[model samples]
Target: MPAPERIPSRGLTDTELLTLLAEGRLTVLGQVRGASNAVLHCTVAYEGEERTCVYKPVAGEQPLWDFPDGTLAQREVAAYEVSEATGWGLVPPTVLRDGPYGQGMCQLWIETPGGGTEPSLLALVESEEPGEGWKAVGFAEVGEGRTALLVHADDPRLRRLAVLDAVINNGDRKGGHLLPAPGGRLYGIDHGVTFNADDKLRTLLWGWAGEPLTSEAVEALGLLAAELAPGAALATRLAELITRAEVEALRGRVAGLRTAGRHPEPSGAWPAIPWPPV
Candidate 1:
């Protein structure tokens, strides 16, 4: 069944969500196993196929007052593309479509496998147990085939994500946002406050006081640097999504880090990043 031609801004409520599903309005096959804010995940039949999708049906103009930026709804799509462009398809694939709920968006649902829980990169490396390290990720539900984000300690993927987070100045890299897929594939989400030029390093992942930078790691940084040179297409594309100021500020930080050859360390006295990101 085709979606209604136009879904209102306020998006779908649970009742309508089910109604549409029953009538083959959009073929929602199963119940919502997990949800947060205005998002829900359910199994559905679409185009003669059984699939599950995460539905984000935002109410119109009722933007997340807490974060208060309407542009994020627009940016999430672009960010997915950016990660794909950067040779990191670890991110989720998305399908922006009308919802059975509010102004709906359908993203391909990625099932968290029963392969243990998401590892906490912070805990994996923090043998020092120095201070409050990135807390242990919840795996109870995950390993039991329930829904939850995952991450791990000692994972090279988290290291790469940390670098990418710093580069993007992602302000929302909470423990829960780092979803680890079935077989050790890690993915980051909730990038609403990203692309800021300022220092937005508010995450819980680091080891040995964030320690000295490794040579191989620096090589990856160098690789990214070389890829983002002036007139570089990737950098140019990023410039369009975020303000030129934000992009330039990001470039400066990357350059400085490359020059210094270091993993980022906390400098200011700001408290740790909040978990679950509202």
Candidate 2:
């Protein structure tokens, strides 16, 4: 697990993502709530319908974000690209970019047929199943919608996210980040804090701790473990964003669990789960 070079955002640039959208369609969509640095909700004008999006200023007063100014946005862009390329199904496609401030990431917004997130996912998690109640609770959208991603245990998709979260060492993956759109489609958002290699997998999605793994989940983990080997080739963005130790840990975690033949346990310690699950 060699450390990847410091190539922020894999190789995709912010403006470049913006240019990916049709030209001469710059328009302000909306305003997002929150004051962490420069978080805001924005919409980018696109073909046919106006795609919803998020806006985060690059010139922020935060350190260690790689891009203290505008790096997170760029990294997010790169991450989305990688996920789309690898068919990881973790993130949405980058529809367009407004120089990092806002991005038109056009994955199906996970809206119900005609409304915000559907609640079926939540209901399923609340059922009598494994890992049904160990999730952190809070809602915060990087976008403008007041709707939050409804995440619950029992959903194989949730487990898949855990595998990805573990591999990326996502320091934050509250329930809110897992939005359930109108359809069965689930979207994972706020990947800005992802791609680290430390044991920073802090999240509230483990409510149903120690539940048995689904057969499909086991297979997914098996595939992930295979991809996280020592000499594994990765997308440029992930190589630089994740650490060697993290990759090793990811490899070991995925491999060990699959080999041992069990569902993931709520291991390690954290500060009583984050205040908000977002």
Candidate 3:
């Protein structure tokens, strides 16, 4: 099936978009292919305003050994909460509400530049070391027994996303999850596997592993630490989306980052990078 036409939500304020997604009339346009769970491409309208969105219903979630069943939709919303707290807006506006299929996550759709020719944020180069404007993310097998170094851009937006992923314990951060919207804004999606109480962070943004946290990251972490304190507003909101233990783990991660003052290093207990990295 042909893809639905992209509709930009640039004019709506974050508050307005969230309200529209939560209360608007949702019309499913098509199903997004390649998602492990059902992801519907839909348009949400309210009070004569409309915008494109992606909806993932709880009933369509596949059971994961690590994650609790029927909770992926909530996790997606939790990830959005954490993203918004960071002030980076790395995640598009997302909300959880009743949909045609059931309760699900509805997120504002982002429109990328035409022709899939948006400048590359990730690449595989023959050189062992990455050139300027790029950060090496280790190596990958290309085909025919050849290997190439995998790298992502040295962009600050990606760097911020890395920090946010750390806070959420994101277990998947594949290249396809990075959405480069118009006006240079970058957003990350498909956070259903996130916010686990365990150390399951897997991503291609490990380029800055062990580096000193950027001043901006430190500042964001500081604010997050306060907001995640027991009974804080953000904490209260998150408790509704995630388990209490998971919420506590999130607090520990932010505190740990502030104390370490550096990006997290892989613990070696699990896979450091997700499969099919791009």
Q: Which candidate should be chosen as best, given lDDT against the real structure?
A: 3
- Local accuracy of candidate 1 as per-residue lDDT tens digits, 10-55: 3554334333333323445544533434556566563344445655
The deviation in Å at residue 217 for candidate 3 is 0.5
Q: After superposition, how far is residue 79 of candidate 3 from its true place, in Å?
A: 0.7
Predictions ranked by lDDT, top down? Answer: 3, 1, 2
Residue lDDT tens for model 3, 1-278: 11112234657777888999999999999999888899999999999899999999998999999997339999999999987777777788899999999999999988777623245789889998999999999989989999999988998878999999999999999988888777777788899998889999999899999999999889888888888988888999998999988998999999899999999999999999998675
The total of clashing pairs for model 1 equals: 14
Instruction: Point out the worst 10-residue segment of candidate 3 by lDDT.
Output: 1-10
Model 2, 1-278: lDDT tens digits are 11112212234344443443434244445544554556545445534434444555555425674323335555455455444432346665543344444443332233334443335444322323234343533343535654453345455567666655654556677656766643255667666665554445676565434666656556566565555555655433345544555445556666666776654554556442455643
Candidate 1 similarity to native, TM-score: 0.63
Model 2, residue 203: what's the lDDT? Answer: 65
Pairs with steric clashes in candidate 3: none
**Each candidate: what lDDT?**
0.54, 0.49, 0.88
Candidate 3 all-Cα RMSD:
4.8
